[model samples]
Target: MAKKWDLFEGYLKCDPNIKAAEVVTDYVENYRSQAISEEVQPIIDRLEKAKADYFNSLFDLYEKEAEYMRIDRKVKDIAGVNYYIKPVVDFSDINLINEPEIVGAQVLTTRLFPTAVKREKYSYEEGAKA
Candidate 1:
């Protein structure tokens, strides 16, 4: 990871155009600003990149949610029914007596997708009264 920072530093130093060098230098500076250790710049930059990527992914997901809701239930049911509506479900009767280690949780997270099960609307008058 240090190699990446070294490379970026070298690029900033060697570039003839001050503007280009400044951009790289600024990015390097911003990316590494949080780290007090000079040697940790690469790690910081990698983390910053990861943070940006993660945020963008979350943002893109929010933008995609509109289309996800518009899709009909029949299709979702076949894909595993109503899975999307409550996709990534979890319920547990178990309890931890103490703070758990990393290995404690055995829960699984499902991909966000709609459920396919057709929920029949209950009508008292139409059924029993009729």
Candidate 2:
């Protein structure tokens, strides 16, 4: 009868977090148990630093992935800018104003950046009815 290597190997593979975590606990215990010179213990310290560097690299990758989703380049010249800034929600921003009631509502109030929208849409101090 042939032995199934894949089935046996499946039990051995562990999650990186579980594996790294377990290795860390074991490393600490092993280091503590060994008879050693005071100077030799720094090797264990190096392992901790290397483990930290590995996780830091993983974090840096995730941040880059998030940043890549944004509109990357800003138009330098004002005249060169265009409608809704081409999908960028800039208040000085252009956005999908998603009030379902206002979805089809015309932007009767679009004023490009630097070009002021002409209206007295608000009173600096409107008093309530007494």
Best by lDDT: 1
* Model 2: per-residue Cα lDDT over 13-129, one tens digit each: 853334555555654665334424332444466558766986696567557645643543433333255533332322234232244323333333452322233433322124211
Per TM-score, the best of the predicted structures is 1
Taken over the whole model, the C-alpha lDDT of each candidate is 0.48, 0.42
Model 1 lDDT at residue 29: 75
Query: Once model 1 is optimally superposed onto the true structure by TM-score, how far is the C-alpha of residue 93 displaced, in angstroms?
Result: 19
Give the range where candidate 2 is weakest over 10 consecutive residues by summed lDDT.
Answer: 121-130
Worst 10 residues of 1 by lDDT: 87-96
**What TM-score goes with each of the models?**
0.30, 0.26
- Candidate 1, backbone clash total: 12
Residue 97 of candidate 2: its Cα lDDT? 28
In model 2, the Cα lDDT at residue 130 comes to 18
